[model samples]
Target: MTEQGPVELIHLADSENSVIVRVVGATSAGLPGDGCLIAEIVAASEFANGRLTEVYLLPDDLDDWAEALELLAAGRTVSWMDDGRNPEVRIELKGPYISQGQTLNAVEVEVRDASVSLTAVRVLVRLPDDWVDAHRRKLDQVHKAWPLGAR
Candidate 1:
């Protein structure tokens, strides 16, 4: 399958326990808070048909009303793993990751204040059940310590 460029990543905290991430074309789009280009999902392919075990952000072209419709689309299968560069910034989501749930079993989001782009965005799964709670707490601390507004 052919590979495509990384998508623009943006994050927003909907509430104390939930967050919203918007993935758009590799263009200069509006981002939440005051940060610019917080992080990126490098070398991401398209989402495949059937059940997905992890969170895969499908490009807008392949989705209809935010739902994937075609399996024959190019780059329909993708994977996300750590390259051992910065493991601390990796993100983790629950297994069988689906879009309809709206609430993930676990999620880890990495954020930075730099105006530059981050090369990697990691999403991890297949871990303990309680991993989400722990990560959420850590994210809360990060939000309090270095808010995107001030950065």
Candidate 2:
């Protein structure tokens, strides 16, 4: 029997309970958002021969937060935008991190604005459940070394 490889996961959300998660291959085209690149993840039952049956965007009306949370628990990246109209909150992936066949999981995004300075932004990408404990400890170090603001 052939072993099924790990599924690629990406997630997006907002402060107002909006969330979207997608699973696809490295070469698949990502869903376009205002400033971030997102992919759509449909229900497994709805997948017809490896295609998504539906898609979603931020600020959904339905109460689907549970499902969204489940996807995050399953090792999907979770990203959230502050407000759709805020230009400073816009987040873009930088080089080296954006590569083919890589999966991001449980990414938390916080957007802030200051009077004396530009917007202060924070992004947190949670390591996978199966990752070594040492890797999780590196999260702070990684972000500390990163330059502030979006690309």
Candidate 3:
């Protein structure tokens, strides 16, 4: 919430099953001692035909979702940082139907400046089902129209 930059959603991989989402950001002045990054991972099987059974936040930087929620509930600022080395933060969700149809279905989100440059936000998701075809088609259409850096 510290004057966050733009949020970009990049699809890393999309198939029939499983999805990995990564949320990241770059820092220009480094991580603040009193700031932390809050990440929220929500997976719904109703839409993707899979239920969210597990969730993980990588880098072990700040606190987990529970801890973050606690702090936030107590009125605290959750700030994140990127020193250009670490992955910033990663969220992985697993479910029973994660690998039903295909074996390679993942979506990654990448956030960057809309104009100038610098900093980014990446989210990767893995979905299980035959939705890959539609996703691919959508991606193709988006690419054709935007070309690059259109997000």
Candidate 4:
């Protein structure tokens, strides 16, 4: 995570491909009453680039992400804003773990932009060193920094 910049909503990256879901404007600055954020979900590969900068990442989506880490660690698949379109961020464990505290494992990430010509790219990321904890901490920081107001 970049300490000097804002916390990323979701980030999956490697040398070849990079997919990110990031919020635009302030959380409170979104629609009134509901107050939702307009996020940008981007999928970039060495060959092509796809971006969905108008995706609506609701407050409930943030709540879902907090649970996603748990499901992923438990070998369950999860997706964020997977409305059969947009840049869907789906992640799942590659295989069963060999042992407990196995910080290193394989994860499959898929970034699909069905809204624009249906662009999908999947990558097997070598999730290193307690990825769940790392991501949880980042999520925690984001929640703390840009906490949404009460309904």
Q: Whole-model lDDT, candidate 2?
A: 0.31
Instruction: Please rank every candidate by lDDT, starting with the best.
Output: 4, 3, 2, 1
Q: Identify the leading candidate in terms of lDDT.
A: 4
The sequence of per-residue lDDT tens digits that candidate 1 reaches over residues 1-151 is 0033323222322223222232322212363322432333232212211111113322222222112112111213222222232122223333444445443333444322122345333333233334334434544443443333443
Per-model lDDT = 0.29, 0.31, 0.33, 0.67
Supply candidate 3's per-residue lDDT for 73.
34
Worst 10 residues of 2 by lDDT: 42-51
When 2 and 3 are scored with lDDT, the better candidate is: 3
Question: Candidate 2: where is the Cα deviation over 4 Å?
Answer: 1-64, 81-108, 112-120, 123-151
TM-score of 4: 0.73
Candidate 3, TM-score vs. the true structure? 0.23
Q: Whose TM-score is higher: candidate 1's or candidate 4's?
A: 4
Pairs of residues at least 3 apart in sequence or in different chains that clash in candidate 2: 22-41, 77-106, 78-107
Q: Per-residue lDDT of 126-145 in model 2, one digit per residue for the tens? A: 33334323322332222233
Please identify which of the two predictions, 1 or 3, would achieve the higher TM-score against the true structure.
1
Candidate 4 per-residue lDDT over residues 1-151, each given as its tens digit:
2345546676766566666676654444444534555677777777777776766656677788888988876778998667764467888777444445654566777877776575677776655647777778777766665566552
Per-residue error for 34 in candidate 3, Å, reads 46
Enumerate residue pairs that collide in model 1: 91-122, 91-124
Pairs with backbone N, CA or C atoms under 3 Å apart (clashes), candidate 4? none
Provide the lDDT at 66 for model 2.
33
Number of clashing residue pairs in every model? 2, 3, 33, 0
